[model samples]
Target chain A: MWDEKETDRKLCIICSKGTLDMAYPGLVLANAALMEGIDVTIFFTFWGLDMITKREMSNLKFTPIGNPHKMNFGNRTIGIPNAVAGFPGMTNMATSMIKKEMDKLEFPEIPEFLEMITDAGGKLYACRLSTDMFQLHEEDLYEGVEGIVGATDFMELSEDAQIIFI
Target chain B: MTSREIAGKTIEFDEDGFLANPQDWDKDVAQELAHEVGIDELTASHWQVIEFSRSDFDERGEAPTLRRLKVAAGVPTKDLYELFPKKPAKKIAYVSGLGKPHGCI
Candidate 1:
């Protein structure tokens, strides 16, 4: 009932957040969309580029400040209030806990997920403005990153796609 | 739980018509369910998706989301749409007797 047209077949996901937790939604969604045989392109801008950066990619840190507590301890999924996230060493604890839980589920690590997305035929692009502002070179990006693109390029490319911002 | 009678069997379903108990599902049920959703006949390719969906649901204790199905079922989005039409993910989950996957579906 949302629209008379057939379901959208192409998806454009924008990733602007850089935290480890913030990265999964875009990555997992892109992975899922590609699997469904939908064409997917992910635009990583601002801090999001850290996800695809060869130097700082794999060990991206989780910032407990203003982070939502997933409340997952061990294998149990819980929800902790955001207020508690401000305590000392909370970011470290949260990161370790989340990594452990993700590992238990056999989900690929961030680097592996990026590779999987590219291998699965999804496209990855870094924002040109962000790259230039940050002084990052193409050599600083991981393999399979389609060159840095500007806002206009992304909008034109995604004109026919269902846009998702994360 | 709601229900629809298919092939003389009373199969329970959730609000969106996905089979409440996936075990209530069978080939006859799948074919009948497909018809209810506007698929007049189930083709070999359609059966491929249903079989994969059901097996994956059984193995994972969860319905394979479109992403999981892409890897495990080996069917692309284009063909899935051609087979099941609009909202293919939800339709396939219903036709294949699995719960609705979480998200916009």
Candidate 2:
């Protein structure tokens, strides 16, 4: 019953987490929507602001503490206990493992992914409150970010649009 | 399997309107397909993308994603959007007579 030609669909993704694993879902979904000719906007808040933060975007860590899923490493599956996951270097280990898998699958890094989205005409925004709390400025974020806006502005921008929170 | 006449030849298309067989594609077919999608003409830049896509599909057995096009074909992302408009990935696949790209991003 959905008619794409008759309707201009829009998608708004709320990215609230900053983990390497979490950061990708929002970016991937935003890009997918753009590929479908849907208008897309991503709002970054809380730790999610790190996704747009220049210094931290590329170095996001994958914390294994709360992840219960097993990871596959070239025919070997490994599960890290919560205790072991908290140990030093575990985060780095997990991050690198996932990053390698992502690369093998041809997924780009976060900054490049953001660039792809921007090039496709997808809009990116940072939460003003979060920027203030994190002491981040416009200059501290990725150059492609359109603006740092409040919740109300986001609501207006995403009016009648389907929203996904990641 | 549905078929439509393109460039004076009856070409089979998948349920999604993509060419059922990549071998059925030709430059004239591409020009007609591009016109169906609101592209009045296929310029030299368009030919570059189409040629790259066809060769890439022959090697990979699947259509290339926008990222692959940008990285491997030396086409920039902005230029791809300009060439194909609203949905560059799907448009390129459609015009190139290949299956839709399966990558999420």
Candidate 3:
């Protein structure tokens, strides 16, 4: 028999990408879970560590290269070719466009989003090996990060919880 | 939808228990809703959030998200969690008789 009340629902989200588009999904999911009274833990590894690195968190970029979706500008849907998207300033342009759209929807910046999650009781952790590979220290991470932990520690922390990899 | 007697008045609720018609809310109904969600008493702090949410909903026709509550209503996110416990956004909306917040954040 299923016992809904006896089960304390939990969610563990693994963020492995650093791009601006990649970052928000994990964050938004974590925030939504916390809003619903579920326990949430987020693990940052690989390029995703950029999401918590103080120097890079706010400056994360979105690259439209290889993405086939057409971007809507006012009433027009324009698709950027891979070649054009790879031009020098294209990344910055794409990043700013995405940022503007996100702002219009009232999504907070990366650091502020992390603060909201932490304040709402969501847990954040950096993957130890990734931090070492990237030569990042505890001080380099956002203040809300709990700690740097290995895979095993993350497993223990996320025990009995549903897992999401982004 | 389901109907329940809360605070001596019959109230209609949606599938998730949010008020079907937000107009069917009053202070007494809010108190009972808060109690149903494990809040024993509606303290000044709790009422602060509830009142702000109701008025915000009235203007926007939607419940305020935690960020809106913090930025617009001047309630801190930390205080909201403490007041509403685990689910501040949904709890505040439920108690305020507003629809669920649609934004992911």
Best by DockQ: 3
The regions of model 3 sitting more than 4 angstroms off are: A1-7
DockQ of 3: 0.54
Candidate 3's error at A72, in angstroms? 3.3
TM-score for candidate 2: 0.95
- Tens-digit lDDT string for candidate 2 (B1-105): 788788998999877767888898888998988987768999999999999999999898888889899889989999998998887887888889887678676
How do the residues A32-113 of candidate 1 rate in per-residue lDDT, one tens digit apiece? 7754568899999999999999988888777656646566565886554677767788778777877877766556678878
- C-alpha lDDT score of every prediction, in listed order: 0.78, 0.89, 0.89
Off by over 4 Å in 2: A1-7
lDDT for model 3: 0.89
Candidate 2, residues A50-80, lDDT tens digits: the string is: 9999999999999889888887676899799
Q: Global CA lDDT of candidate 1, please?
A: 0.78
Off by over 4 Å in 1: A1-5, A9-12, A28-40, A65-94, A115-123, A133-144, A160-166, B1-12, B31-60, B66-92, B103-105
Pick by DockQ: 1 or 2, better one: 2
Error (Å) of candidate 3 at residue A100 is: 1.1
Root-mean-square deviation of Cα positions for candidate 2 versus the true structure, in angstroms: 2.1
lDDT of 3 by residue, A4-121 (tens): 1322799999999999999999999999988878899999999999999999999999998999988887787767899899999999999999999999888999999999999998
Taking all chains together, each candidate's TM-score versus the true structure is 0.63, 0.95, 0.93
Rank candidates by DockQ, best first.
3, 2, 1
